[model samples]
Target: MSVLPRTPPRVARRGRAVPVGGVLLFAVGGTAATIAVVWWVAAHTGSAWSPGGDLAVYRDAAQAVRAGGSPYQVDRDGYGFVYPPFAALVLTPLAVVGPLAGYAIWTVLSTLAVPAVVWLLVDHLTPAGDHRRPTLLAVGTLAALPLSPIAGTLLLGNVNIVLLALVLVDLLRVRGPQQGILLGVAAGIKLTPLVFVVHLLLTGRIRAGVTALASFVGTVGVGALVLPADSVTFWAGVLDSSRTRPPGEEAYGGSIRGAVLHLLPEAAHGVWLPVSVLAAAAGLAVAVWASRRHEELTAILACAVTGLLVSPVTWYAHWVWSVPVLALLVARTWRRPAHRRWPAGLLWLVFALPLPWWVGYVLGWAPLTEPAWMMPVDLLYTVTAVALLVLAAVWLRRTAPAARGCPR
Candidate 1:
């Protein structure tokens, strides 16, 4: 008789399975609550409250475009234009609907899209056969509700969410031809997202980078062709306006640059250029490391999120990109035993603590003039960026050996 080989005792499965039903209930409840709160605020605030300053500018530009007037030539109190002609063209339809209605529709759609996008990013990152789907789903919901920047985006009626979605989707599907088109669309809407072009280039995705550049050029070319004479006027006006406007006049309160200036009052107007240059250099360094390390998509996503925060001009709503970063944090932590839970908890706290502050600011409950207590917002942003960089550095250290295997 052949002796049967003794099987090794199965190790106890680590981490608990998430409850799907509970996650669904929390998501639905949280979404409903968020909508209700926003609607109430909008109704109560009425004309006394305006969306973020950027929204006002965009709305005016939309109206200008719709009135058979050129947005490029229309100087709103000498506030120079920054957006391209393509933005005005896109806003034409919204202008027809009126700013309030357009803002309402955008807020609703963006708020709903936040969780779905977070879920997609998380699903893409997590390994298959993990029994942590419920935990991941719950985490996604929390991210969309608490830590994510959707609240501020909705409250401010900002376009950052749409730009963010386009950028995230482009990064997620960087291998596709459509990535170039999407990147172009994002850059056309908001110029800052153009940084991704550099990211694509440094990664040796030369064809994709070229395609992105071509798409951007084609977009501007078409816009110029359509607007023709007005395009030149608009470009000139924007450059002049951006230079002359002071921070207070520009309503820079909610941006990283504004926050920094708020905390360090001495640097007020002069900090933007230096801060922008430093952010660019840091971003380039991170992108180079990511390329050399052959880092995972999650690591790349983290880099992108960190890059945004480091930028001097980033606003609170733009933090919506952090949803994916938080998702990655949760998914990674969930895979390990209970003893490894601190990182996940810290991530959640960092993501959650700022929601109330953002909401308070948007609602006018937390004015920027209230002494230096407001400095925490800037500090929090700085901490978040540093943490993400640390995470990427650690991951790079671990993957360096594996990445060396690729042919030089």
Candidate 2:
């Protein structure tokens, strides 16, 4: 089949047997209802958090952009607003609306993205004729909502959820050369998704990889043209938090590299460096093998998990990959004799709880003396992410040769 469709497809898309409007109504309506319900409960219970805290920084950057100034001047979590100029350019509209109104729009879109991701995964990965796509979509979105990654993204008003949706639409929905453009725009805003380009190349989608790279460069070029000073400041490494704060000191960082380094007393880039590199190499190797075996979803997921592990400073927000990752696992294992399905449930429970935050409360995050017991809890997502990668590779290796030709 051609990647580009010249006319309306004779058959409807795999995941969109239902109309898009209906899906949006369900997703957006459900998400908004959940918010209202939660707010009502919180009001009665005297417990609540103001969502869109991070949008304040976004607004600050957007204001700077509107004033023809540099966005890198703003701070986020004690670090600089650590994104490319294109990201600020994208947020410029928020400045026009002001922070409160911006949060309203961003939060609504972010909520829509949360369930849209689930819709995409269910539409693509679930076996046909299952008759449970919508149910699973709703369940998966609800399951993901309380999980730290999605929850933190929603509460903090971050870009991770939207970026997840962008990447998913690019990979699962887009059938043309345009497949890579969304992913490229995502990577332009945050560098982690750039790893998908390498995934495309290793899987023999060389054209897709090249297109993604070109799109990324085009974003940078646009940034340079529109926000020359800010783009130069960013590209010159002016806003790099890693430059001043050693990886070990980033207690909130959930990457394997950061978690391991934090446990040590001194700066150990050498120690953390080789380990994360090796982990990434192994992950990409598994991803390549899965691609060769035609386990395309597994291959795509392996790359996503690998990116979370290897990024210098992954946080709870970056683990937004967990929702689809878990959903894919459940989809592949459901009603199958070849593999057990219970492990996916176990993983869901792990991600659903605030394990690290519980540990933080115990350790009194006062300058954070992460004791031995706290290490595992603090490293919960990182270690599990690494294990999830290894386990996926192992499961792929164990599948019978006869089953190798089918894409799962």
Candidate 3:
């Protein structure tokens, strides 16, 4: 069976093309710039910006589980373990080492996940026979490492990259009946990835969807068997607080819901929920439309973007999905006429800049400033997400076969 549909012939019928050497040189230069910026931030911030504070939290949660305590209630440095019970169980091996050692180990693993995800995206998105695929993956991953969202994930030692790799591997690499298991495992670790289950169902991969759902249920069953009380506590709304954005986090939280709360009055925060519902509806409709056109990657990405936008508390670290989005945009633009590919170049510049969470960093900055100036800066991430969603719709329509009608 075909691993992926062939790139539309029009993509291969290119006219003027970008010079590969220039692209590589620019990528290397961008990578160096990112390193300088990260080094500057680390030096200025000192240990306040130390790596693995979040990994340390996960380590403590794992230790709690090992000691027959409730991992759900475990908190370290005021950060609670917001992941599912199975995640704690999975991390239990870390308890063998001290927190510092665990941090080092997690940092190495998470760092490696960066390039791994890059390879997965490049390998799947580009033609299998393209010689430049390795170079593309290397340049993309190097450039991505310095981006605020991806860099922040590395600095904080989060599992978002690992989760991203799992989803991409399931979609782009996996074969046979077990294809969806990794996706389910990812969703079990963090609930946000369940959006892929919806994607699979909409795309008519019923068996794979059922397999993913069962794998998720299997994780819950394992948790129940190992720690019955904690399982009950987690499944109930009690552990919901674990996933809630901390008070004062909304300013730079970057989700549409978070942006809505920041821009509106306190009472109007309730409006975010309804707005999120509408966004989810629209985003999912786009995903379904892409799926109907046999654009599997586009469908999956639409769902991923939707989940990020609709979630109440998507932090900068959770934007690892942006890496895949960048790869897709670059690929799409590579296939376009030379003059029409400016969006790809503009977007790369946008992602390369340090994300401006400074307004939030400077307390009361929003209120002190005029709405005209502050509102756009505050909603930068949300705007980027909406733009990507629009791009996905445009690409779907442009690439859809003439025989297939656009969704109404």
Best-fitting candidate, scored by TM-score: 2
lDDT of 3 by residue, 336-401 (tens): 678998876777666554444422333333333333433454377788888888877876777633
The TM-score measured for candidate 2 stands at: 0.83
lDDT of 2 by residue, 146-227 (tens): 7877766776678899999999889777876787999899989888899899999888898889889999999999999999
Which regions in candidate 3 have their CA more than 4 angstroms from the true location? Answer: 1-50, 238-243, 250-252, 337-340, 355-378, 402-408
> Which 10-residue window of candidate 2 scores lowest in summed lDDT?
1-10
- 1 against 3, candidate with superior TM-score: 3
**Candidate number of the best lDDT:** 2
Please identify which of the two predictions, 2 or 3, would achieve the higher lDDT against the true structure: 2
| lDDT of all predictions | 0.62, 0.74, 0.72
Report how far off residue 210 is in candidate 3 (Å): 0.5
Instruction: Give me the runs in candidate 1 sitting further than 4 Å from their true place.
Output: 1-29, 46-56, 72-81, 128-135, 237-279, 302-312, 337-339, 357-375, 398-408
Deviation (Å) of 66 in candidate 3: 1.8
lDDT of 2 at 87: 89
Best-to-worst TM-score order: 2, 3, 1
**Stronger candidate by TM-score (2 vs 3):** 2
Residue 76, model 2: Cα distance from true site in angstroms: 5.5
